[model samples]
Target chain A: MRGGDAGFDEFVRERYDQLLRYAIMLTGRRWDAEEIVQEALLRCLRRWRRVPADNAVAYVRKAIYHEFLRVARRKPQVPLDELAEQLDLEDFAPAVVARDHVLVVLQQLPPRQRAAVLARVVLDLSEAQTAVELDCSVGTVKSLTSRGMARIRQLWAAEQAAAPGRRGT
Target chain B: MIAEEQEYATRLREELADVAVRASAGQVDTVLRQVHRRRRDRRNQRIQVFTAMAVVALAVAGAFAVTTAGEHAEPARQVDATTPMAQWPARGELAADKDLVARAEQAWHSYRQPPRGPLKPLFAGVSPNMSANMVVVALIAPESGQVAFVTTPIRVNRPSDPRDRLLVRAVAPVTPEQRGVGFMASRPLPEDEPPIDQNAVGMALTSPAAENGKVYTSTIDSQSEPSWPTTVVGALWPQYEMGAGAWNSELRVQFRGAASTEDYTLVTGVSDDVDLGPVALRRAGAALRAEGPGVRQGDLIITPNGVVGVVAAPDGTVDTRLSELAAHGTVGVAISRVPGRVREVGDHAEFTATGPGDFGEEQRLVLQAWDEPRLALTFAKLAGYEPHWLVARTAGPDAAENVLRLGKPGAAKP
Candidate 1:
């Protein structure tokens, strides 16, 4: 019934869907992503009294990142075949196939490199912000992103060379 | 120019714009409902804690106020009483002494045969005119442990001054073994101090035999860490139930410091065995075999440099010297444990080694397994940077058998 509780309800209603989408992108599984978002929101609510109004979204995002890291550390290895199957290439256009192929190649990189590339490109965060989120220096993030992209390009070229008929793009 | 690269990047981003983010409507509802439930639960917990703290504060305040009023009234009453000095002093001292004796007795009684089910005070004592009172009881279950309690005083007035009368009572279990270890007062360390760097200072549970019940409070020390200590009192039993086993399990207590980073206090037993699921074992074995000297199931390899030791089996898996092996390279030797079985192409294998070798040093070694191509390479030179000496395993197919040098800029050619 308090004014603060009412405000929190409003905040949750507005950002729940967006946060869920972000979590889904990060985790690559709907069930795990939803669980992560729900846990993040609950944690945010517990400390709502101290959270600054301006940075509420940032706090929620940080919580999501922390939860993701916790789960990733516990189960670091993912089955390659399962991950490959999860990438639905049929949804892409001819030009998009090249990009999808690039993403598949990106998946082959180490976990840290893949995380850096996604945080930079897919999430569109600044280099400094991505570095802070990863608890690393900006130089490390830049290096990882560069190396990750180079590997993707090499794999794409190799795939194109091997499959001549599918190289229309 | 770099502009062309940037343009290509922009096009790549736009092409992948349709990556769908999908979750079922039911899933969303479930998550939202869980969030709401947790919020409510946490709010209720906070309210309960605040309420309990408030009650203790009020009781103490009330007791202090009543004691002050009694002191003021005593002076006025003294003038009216024309009684003899001998009678007055003896009565006053006797009453005080009797009260102290009664409290001590109550504390002793509460220690023995603590009540089961809900917690309750076993003994209650109130001062004359009911101005101050005390109750003593055990807090937790007798089997789990014992906790003592003392009540706050009821203040007559002047609550704003932050002074209150207090009635205190103490209770402990009858048997020394049943009684919980008493509280250890600790001073907060500096902000920069590690949370759990020091040895445990508190009491530890002691078990006599494998199946016997555990006794509490075996050891106590000052200047110890905050978390409780658990002593491994017995060896692993052949057959024991989960959670009731006397198995040699490692105990770890984690503490978070003021900086919000967690530090762990770990204790290890001499022998410990943990089951790695089939999938994990298979993956680990494959990763190990791909990177180092290939190992098949049941084959043993003894390294000449005292670094690598592995036993390989026929099932395309290797049992390393240790369950977790630190990464290092040295001129050690490996022998095939499997007598007749041969390592074929495309087979997943694992190699493990143990030793006091520098992780950064580059060294050459030969790998000979039955029926497999002979392997010769310098692992440190091939793996790029120095491998972590504690545990490092990589997963990939076997590269070519020629000299495999590590730390090359590009991928090493098989």
Candidate 2:
């Protein structure tokens, strides 16, 4: 890692966007999600030699999750409006709004549960993989994902019900 | 339910797809440059914290595993709740006793995890003015490396009213796990010439964590108003229970400068190196076999059901997995005797150097970095281990140096 800036650069270029997406799931705010990924990347660079090359992506992702857990403890139950303040709301693109609406609900899930859902579903990690990333057992992944998804389903359902016409999409 | 899970997964991927880093390449490069600069600055600002391992040449030094081997290990629960607190030294006691100050610095700030109940202070008495002063007691589960504390007032450690015997009795042994605390004079690393030595102070003890306290960061925040009482002493004994985290058990210490109003908290965490994968449960004879949970290099495992069974293993590996009943279940607790508290037990005391290696290199670095390598050697001496070769392999590589035994006293040997 002493002279490995090149590898670090390439990792950022290829994985930054992907890492951001993962962060969004863990941290509802785009700003915090990006910040977590960025900080993790910096640390990844510091301990670069110790981390196996094959596990770089997973390394950063796990760091993101751990960062979320630590940050979650520091700032408890963030309000949706405060999260909104992190964004430039003028755009209001439907994709952005849709993500926003869902995040509002997702924010209600515990940090661990949110990380579980993102890993199992969005990131497409298996129960074992999710467990490893989140530092829990496979059984825990199942339970967290199950409970988290159940809540998301309920919220998604309610959202659709309110805007039946918009639900067509 | 599986289909529903898949549906939920699919919807999330679609909805959250747009989320990505928008920072331009130039912006990113700038950030990296800034990060690199900060790292460089920190290293430049760094002081020599044990640049050389005070090399002392001698014989009769090799890596020794003086492990108590659990046979004689006392279950923390079974251990007597004796108060091990050091008496608060008088102002005269604060006079330049370099050796005693070094001993206090070397004392293990953290003790082994005690079972939860209520904590008894090694010995907490009133300050010179009779403002009650007590040490905080914390429990750490060796298996989980999880720590919990019996929160107490700075002035009144367990707050026992003279009339409240029942209250005191019920809370007498609150912690269920082993317990310990670190008492360094400086709460933080001083940025001056010798960042290694905690700012040589008159008498500054750490203030416990509180909402009304001024200690901001968990680390890198030290404020010791060097007054008298420098040769202070206190110990953490179990009194009450503070539960462990399911995993990622953290060690938290609240420190306040005895002379300053603000207090700070320092935290570190420990967890089993678990592996989780498509392990097929198999039994070969009386013993059950599974490719133990190293699922992958860094993936974590959690039990589906809340219960995790602790299994007894000759080596402390399979304790945090599923039990036969909890099986097909992730492993659970298999309690065994873990190394307990390090206190004045005759001429020797024990300190758990969990820096990342079985040897004490990392711990040495931490102590030395915090200006306490001499403290490590001092503990080694207290434990009656010669200064030639010691090992703290369970800690980290930085830990390798911690356990090295350098040499004999004045008697010279090659």
Candidate 3:
């Protein structure tokens, strides 16, 4: 295969899903998130020849993250409930439903803590990788992840206490 | 509780796995198409830039060839200061299209004058040989010494001929000092009116030669009229008798009084030509007949030249011609929020005025509705600014008839 075609097909097959999932996590809104993903992918295609083959996925993921942040910043502040409404659960499994609930709870944390939690839990990246991705120290990333988990636990415990009969469910 | 945290992490991993990474069908294609279009546009732009550079290079080379071939080219040709170089080509010819003239004219018309009388003629009747769509007129008040320049966008239906459809695009105000000399009016003060003070106002006239030479004295107290028919002492005052035949002349008058310590001057061009005198009056009359008596004072009569003739009436009836001139002189349109007490929900506040001179001329009208927070909020997010939702449902003949959505930052009703 020619260099450009080989690069393009490989990028689509390898990184398309991961970028879309990241975009969905960032924007909450399905259609807008999809659009952000598409834009980032196109930008990647334009600079495909220049990107190192080994770090192509990382580069595209960063592009998606940046585009998501840009759109979020430009948009007016939406209520947390309105953001939740933008999420779709048609194909959600029990695990997916739990994850969605956790995402809602996680949003209450500050932006840095939320990023740390998403990187560690959702992305399953190492603490050092999360720190590098977030442009913070590993120690800071560890502390933020710890605090984020604690906050989520406290919120869930309060909810369970408020509803005694539905504890198992 | 620790097990639940582990479960949450597992669920997040499952959800991330379930998340689809691929774009919707054709989305990639669409994006690629957009990229291709942008690349094509960039390529076209580059070709155009290269072509322009090549043409310029060729022209320079040809000029050099001509100069080198001719021994007579040794003596550098001297050009008159007023007349631009013909062989070298005038920048005005290249830049002076219908749009440029229209833009210049619009700018001249939209120029904001200090709270004072009409603007003087900047220049009228471009050289017949020059085919231009744009014309800029600048007027400076001799008394206040405030200068106003307007550039208008114009569309010339007849580019080959000097006279044709001269549609003005937009009028904007420019700095006064930048306007050429002889564009501003200067006048001597009358002794009886008041002593000339440093604060006295001066004016310059530009258009309508009939009103050009006449100088008007501004009085601080509306009740106090200037003592005219006194001896014209100042050397600035040239002796010229008003001919029985209709003549177009510019007059500059300066006044000083207790109410206004500064010299206040008014410059206007008067045309003894009867034909032009009543065009504005006749138009205003027609507007009154059609629109009924909504026409009041403080409205503007915008001319094709984009000159704003304001309607000043302390009384209901605008009977006096001099009052008309003083009120409607070339000046800035004043836009202010309607008194909130007078404004109510669902009710649009309207202001109207008659033309200054003839009934045939077009009158001015402006309507503003109270802005609703909800509507403004929705549009503000989309537009990036709170836009003033004012609609010009109806305008006189010369006014632009489009529904303009003015952004709040630099909102002007005119």
lDDT of candidate 3 over B266-361, digit per residue (tens): 122111111111123334653321121333344333221122233444332223221232222221111111111111114332222222111001
In model 2, the runs with Cα more than 4 Å from the true position are A1-6, A85-98, B48-414
- Using Cα atoms, each model's DockQ against the true complex is 0.11, 0.13, 0.13
For residues B131-166, what per-residue lDDT tens digits would candidate 2 score against the true structure? 222222322223333333222222321332211111
Could you tell me how far off, in angstroms, the CA of residue B274 lies in candidate 3 after the best superposition?
Answer: 63
**Top model number, TM-score:** 2
Q: Once model 1 is optimally superposed onto the true structure by TM-score, how far is the C-alpha of residue A136 displaced, in angstroms?
A: 3.5
Q: Across residues A1-169, which tens digit of lDDT does each residue of candidate 1 receive?
A: 2334446656766676667655655665444666788888888777777767776776787788788778777876556567555544332111112333444555576657766767777778889988877779999998988887666566666777999786433
For candidate 2, write residues A1-169 as lDDT tens digits: 3355557767777776677667876777765775687677777777876777777889888988888888889976777687655443422121233466667777878888888887877777888898899999998898998999988888778878987876543
Model 3 residue B147 CA deviation (Å) reads 50
Instruction: Report the C-alpha lDDT of model 1 over B1-414, residue by residue, as the tens digit.
Output: 156445445644665465444333433443555566456445544654665577578678987774643441222224112332111221111123334434433443454443444332222222111111111111333443333433323222112111122222222232323211121101111211221112111111111211221211101111223321111121111111111111111112222223321111111111112111111122463344412332233322222111122434344343344321222122232111111111112322223233221112122222222221211211111122222222222211231111111121122323
Global lDDT of model 2: 0.38
User: Worst ten-residue run, lDDT, model 3 chain A?
Assistant: A90-99
Chain A TM-scores of all predicted models: 0.71, 0.84, 0.74
